[model samples]
Target: MHDAVIGGGRSPLQPRALVARSWSRVLEAGLDPDGRHPRDPLPMDQVLARRRESPVALVIEELRAIISSVADASQFLMVVTDADGIILWREGAARVRGRADSLGFEEGAEWTEEVVGTNAIGTALAEASPVQLFSAEHFEAEQHPWYCTAAPIHDPRTGELLGIVDVSGPAMTLHPAIVALVETAVRLAESQLWRHHELRLERLRAVAAPVLASVTGPLLLVDDHGWVAHTAGIAAQARIAVPRDRRPLTVPGLGLCLPEPLGDGWLVRPAGGETRIVMTLDLTGPPAVAVSGERPWRAPLTARHAEILLLLHRAGRSGLSAAALSSRLYGDAEHVVAVRAEVSRLRRTLGGVVESQPYRISPAVEMAVLGAPAG
Candidate 1:
């Protein structure tokens, strides 16, 4: 593979190792190189809906200015896709857009290797790396006229593969630096995404501070999928398995307990022991929770408020920054105003329990989960 030649000559007739591999995979999948069109293009409405809900939507929005700045005078088109290669957004020169539309390269088109043969979008995702394909490097005869560079974008928090961002234009427009340009854009998008997550975490930390201020024992805060967001008193060696479904299970160290629904996740505490304090998170209707200890109290929480609390609890004493909380809450860290306003309301509701300045819960409190054994 190292010895394989990359694009250089006037015509990109030579297949790089990665492109050659993609060609092989395409052939094995039984796609015809002469196929006139790709398969399973989503409807425009569906594509718009997906874009609205996609995690990368905000990133793409933020990149609009950068995209225009970098590609305004060029024929290159900017494309964003979901991990599966469904194009969610495409923007560029009108002439180039028309050409791309003729080739079924519009939004909602699926460009997976199995569907579209060897192309930059599918190949980059398949190889999990940045890729540039030019002219004859593409397996499909029709795609040979196009040159494209693409790079996969990943979740900043979980490192999960989110999708790919690509730049495409006529083969004659190919530049050696296009690959680097696409890579830079992907990095900027990822950085923006990270900032958003940090903001959301910060908001959560603010809400959890009050709840945490009331706890005084080993505790763990986990999201709906059981990913630990925060912890206290529990040793690092303790591995707790949180069930995906709402079922009771015996966790190591914690004993038999069912996860109680809190915010967007579950608050797991021991079922039986010298239980001195109790917190009941009622998610049945309008979100509400009750904390009982020396200071018995209950508060009605809005859905957003509940989510903030859960994230804060998960963050534990390390706390969360505004950027982190904003990302987690709204998928965009730039929504700092929303986070601040929400935190303000939360403080008013919970009183002096929640604190600011790198938001975190008070150490004087300990949160423990308690649930009845699943039937």
Candidate 2:
């Protein structure tokens, strides 16, 4: 047992450094190497209830056909687990399913590292990345005959870990390419989740359009979690993280403000004003714009918004018309409405610093590039 636990030489099939560290943790938990690790299965009714409530339920259902095809060809057991590492769903060839069942790999079984040693499902969840474990690499002696590859799936909206998708089979069936296959499947699942959010955003946009037409000042429509679903006077960046609480929140470029409950999320309005607002644009990374002086605030800009702002800043006294800006932004003069919408959102964040008609920055506001000297 000691020799198996602390081998001197590294085998070609040995676990990666991260997996090895996980194995150490499993041992520290005092799980017996030879003894049968107790199975902690949730009640069948409870498991069914939990699966129904899971956000990934539809995603997993849609991927079933693809997962079935892979399982049939590779003789691998396909398993999906919740974030807690409890098996929520399982599908595979009859023989593989039978073999896995004998080892307590059925639905409702807990496979967290502390509960079941360092297997692919648990380790992938722990590391929040794709992983593969072959034969002896599995910390448990009983699991030594199996090879497994798994990838962590994340909630597209919140970027939170949702669950894991794993493919496991006999060690002799190990194929190095299985890791990539599992990762690809995970990506498809995440994309499906993203589409779900997009659909919800579209519905929210419809509801907001009418409300926005009434408001004269800048306003935005966000989801229940503070993610921007659509905007009227605010730049519709990919997302805006607003505080979940009702406390006064500080917005970048727009000083301290209180969020008023509107539709699914809150409508933010600036509480104070700034005399001299200096805006900094950093084009290298995510392209963020920071407003500095007295009460400082900053916000990230989408690629399109960043380009429009840069063009306007360079225009100086000669502002660009909607048609000219449309051609520059979308390569078509017909997209004037789209150009106007973007400018309106930009104005909301920049306050009176950004002007329309001929889109241009306000004379009082100073614009600076991070790597370049302040102008």
Candidate 3:
């Protein structure tokens, strides 16, 4: 069925829609269906660096405890990769591990659809969802002997993709429950990640409690993402614009403030009662908003938010309505809801610096655009 559908581009027994889509993407990316591609896994030192940097590393023991024992007993390999689909860890029976190595399924190997054709790891990453592929369902002929099930793990705080966890083994031994097992493990991992986040916040609250008691005015102790860990005098807000070291943030109740790092988090104090903020919007390079002064730090902006800010700044006091903003951004007003949603996120990043009667910069903010508004 795989050859008939992918080779001849037609088959009476159609591949699953997801599989077919992955095959199309692999072909479009110029990956060969029949030819073998040899890859050199990244050097052990570099692989170690990535492992140290990946959040997945913290939960690896948990994953190994849950899946590695099963893989070893079942003649399978438990694999983990960063969101880029680069394999970071692989463990199982030595014999099964050897077989995987023959297929270049080793630590540090890039296994995305473009790199190695459609399979569980690559397809899961490409689709940003779970995937299971067996035998001939794989795009690369070399992978026809194996079955793989994989699911993505995401950061509980940001929903940013952390990595993928996969189980792969001989095709004939593929159990119907393998995919479910992988999905369950991913859920457990994400929950554990959230638990870790809460624990960190708890530590921050404990450390800052004494310091906060001494401070008199309305202020907040927030993490790097602007999550309020502890509030001194102000009503607590769930979040403000993300805090960058030394960057001035126009916090809603706190006014413009500079966030200074303290231990694991930052201490956000009103900037000596200075209510006005000066920001530079630089589109000359990768679009970043920079705040300069005693404590100066820069935060990179997403393209969407950058464009929205530019449009808002250009509009001046009038601001752009959701419908008008939608039309300007998407070439149609059909995206009004999307435009509004994005503006909400943008506001979270800039706090009171962004206002939404229509969506314009706050009058208290002095923003200067750098380079062409081409972003």
Candidate 4:
């Protein structure tokens, strides 16, 4: 029920009296005649669950270099606390560290805003701001002797609150450089964490390249910022070159530009800040689209499906008979029958739009847009 008096001691103020006054204010302002505070409290089960799952040590080694550097240069002690306020790591003077731990302020102790009321470490996290608790400003009577400074550590990329970095020792001995020092150190730790995750994702993608190519079809892996990351080898067959020009490349036939380079031969489409992979066959071999009365519809062209279409476009006529077209296409009678069956399936799929007429392909319904636009 204590009012929290927060901030660095800027004026000529007695720290203990400020704490007492703040406490009295909070109790008087918050409590009704029934002595109840009008606020919904969080469930302890959910709080414990979130705290247990927090991974503070995941980047402890990376952060250690900065924490040690800060602690070694400053007279104040440095400690890393998990999201739950449990001190996970420390680097500072041995004397301060010992005294802090002896006062039940060591690793595994929950010093969260909820548990300790209002203190430098807990309050910094609650308010998502840097805090400086001078002597006697701490919520608890026992903690009144020490002053503490803390800042919330966040994942640089995601901006998620990771933990807290704090420096604590005796109060009344204020140093000018403590706040800036802790803030800069926390920022460095966050930068390291982001770099670590980025490297990890890059390595994982490299290892999964082969399998990713096979299952996801031809694709291009792009970064979050719309730059092409990976291009598949098969993409070479397409007119568009993979890793093209160190930027997003245009698809040869499709009217789309990929965000990231398709190193794995995949192109991702961006819509509303979301990326999606689109699968398309390489059409660089030849134009497969044909026009009406262009070429006689061939029964089957095994090797020349693409080339034959081009030839048919140039010559305005129907195609050869099944056996004849087969020989013309691949020079085989059995293959001609197979091609005919495939063409039949194509007709079925095309429905009434495309018609199979002897050795000719005709559009049952004239399409206003057919073949290349008349030059």
Candidate 5:
């Protein structure tokens, strides 16, 4: 079917829409169907570095137990990759692992579609959705003998993609239940990660309790990632931009402020002498955002987040709900999860300037737009 539809351009047994979409993308990338299966994997040192840095690293042993336990070890191999599709951890059937080694499916191999054509790991990353490919469904002829199921693992709190968990083996070993197994593993991993995050926050809260009671005036206690652990004297937002030394942070209602290092988090308070600040969202060129205060700063915005700001600005004081933002941004409201995630990341990046629970620009920020695209 892959050859008939992808090469001959037509087939009575039409490919599944997802598979067809992947074939089209692989073709566009100009990969040869007969290309060699093996490519040079990253050095061991680099692989270790990525493993240490990935959030998925926290749940490696749990994933091993969940996925490998459900399968006949010799019939399946489990692999984990970071958000960029670089394999970080791989284990399971030693026999199947040998097959994977021959195909360069070992750790540190970058399995993104652009590099290896349409396979489970790369396709899941491209579609931002779980994927399964069997036999001839693979874009690469060399991969035609393999079957794989993959699902994206996400950070539960912010909806950020953390990595992918995939199971693969010879086509003869493909199990219909493998996809479900991967999905379950993904859920477990994310929940474990979230639990870890919550525990850290709780510990920080404990450490912060006494310090906050003694402080006067408004302040916020946030972790390194700006997650609010505690607040006092101020009407607090859940998060703010990541705190860094020597850089000024602008908080809604709190005015411009400097973040001081607390035990394991930050203590944020007004940098004194405050006045109303005018912030600008410039849609001109590459999405530029600037804060106009005594200690002014600018943050770079991705085009998507830029559109988000433009929409919020247009929505005025009424603000737009996640469903509304989903419809406006994606032409449908089914993407509420994705919409919320984008908005969460935006709120964290821009801090208090963008308020939530019906997203809108903070009243404290007098926002003006320049060269915004007209609908």
Candidate 6:
């Protein structure tokens, strides 16, 4: 990793206009826009201190491990920065540690675009690209001695920025491989972020079921493209009659469907009680954005509410009866009445948003209720 940082890769071909524009932006902003130090200013003590307050430190540590394995160079230092430019993680040679530390290049120091002007980490974040800064190209005199390469890290599904991965070393040793190495690290981090999102959403889906039992009908989990990810037992059985692979399951033609693509998944039901109860769900492409847990829906919850939500998730959103809900909670009709009262109070609190209609839970309520149970 160190070697790659020092003598790693060729920089991207610079477009004359772009280079001029970038330089113009720098010159127009002048040397100090924020009135802070012109040099990179993160320190090791601060970076270490930030671990408690920031999650990016852990992410950067993983990036360091990845870069070290693929690039394997000593002079090369791998660092992770937040959206604001604070260095969250840095792993490199002891010789350069002083310089890095002096710049507040450690975890807690802020390295946002505002602080460092148009440097690799800041610029890459602004442009959302892989950037290389060698020697004289650095905006600040204090940053002149190092060659730096950085790539933006984005969450795959939502394409939202997570942070950046940067490698820096002595100017003379800058190489072409640095860009590739940084890109590789960024991609790995993105993959990890996406997987984590999916698992979290799935857990929410499982938890929301019972709470929503009184809302409406079957609870269904569909992908962004309309494929089914999961379904309550009732929905599964109802859908079993319909061909699962039939493309583009249209609601009016076959059954009712939610119009919105919620991250917690769609809450839905058959428009008619006599309808086959069968619905088609698409799970064919990349996991749906709704399944990634990026957008969470709020559900009205109480202790009894939570119990009912579980039953709804396990059963269907047919709106469990007081007896059924009570059985789940206290295994007796009297207790069930008490729980039912709680549900009634919760219903009023959630308003029409809870969607109690047609003698059951509404599809929208089911979508939110069956997806994320109250903590």
Instruction: Indicate which candidate wins on lDDT.
Output: 3
lDDT of 4 at 268: 46
TM-scores of all predicted structures: 0.64, 0.64, 0.84, 0.47, 0.76, 0.51
Candidate 6 per-residue lDDT over residues 147-189, each given as its tens digit: 8898887757646576778888878767777777788777777
Total clashing pairs for each candidate: 29, 6, 0, 27, 0, 61
Model 2: per-residue Cα lDDT over 318-345, one tens digit each: 7899999999888899999899878866
- Residue 99, candidate 5: Cα error in Å is 0.9
Q: Output the number of the TM-score-best candidate.
A: 3
Name model 6 segments beyond 4 Å from true. Answer: 1-17, 32-61, 69-73, 202-216, 220-375
Q: List the residue pairs that clash in candidate 2.
A: 233-345, 234-345, 235-345, 252-297, 252-298, 253-297
Q: Model 6: how far is 264 from its true place, Å?
A: 11
Residue 43, candidate 4: alpha-carbon lDDT:
55
Query: Which runs in model 3 stand beyond 4 Å of their true positions?
Result: 280-309, 318-359, 369-375
* lDDT winner between candidates 1 and 2: 2
**Cα lDDT of model 5 by residue, 236-341, tens digit:** 6777777865445677657777788888889898877654457888877789888766567788899999999999999999999999999999999999989978
Error of 4 at 173 (Å): 3.8
lDDT by residue for model 1 over 9-59, one digit each (tens)?
Answer: 244354567876887787789877667754668888999899887899878
> Deviation in angstroms for 357 in model 5?
13
State, as a TM-score between 0 and 1, how close model 2 is to the true structure.
Answer: 0.64
C-alpha local distance difference test of each model: 0.72, 0.76, 0.85, 0.53, 0.85, 0.54
RMSD in Å for model 6: 17.7
Which candidate, 2 or 5, would have the higher TM-score against the true structure? Answer: 5
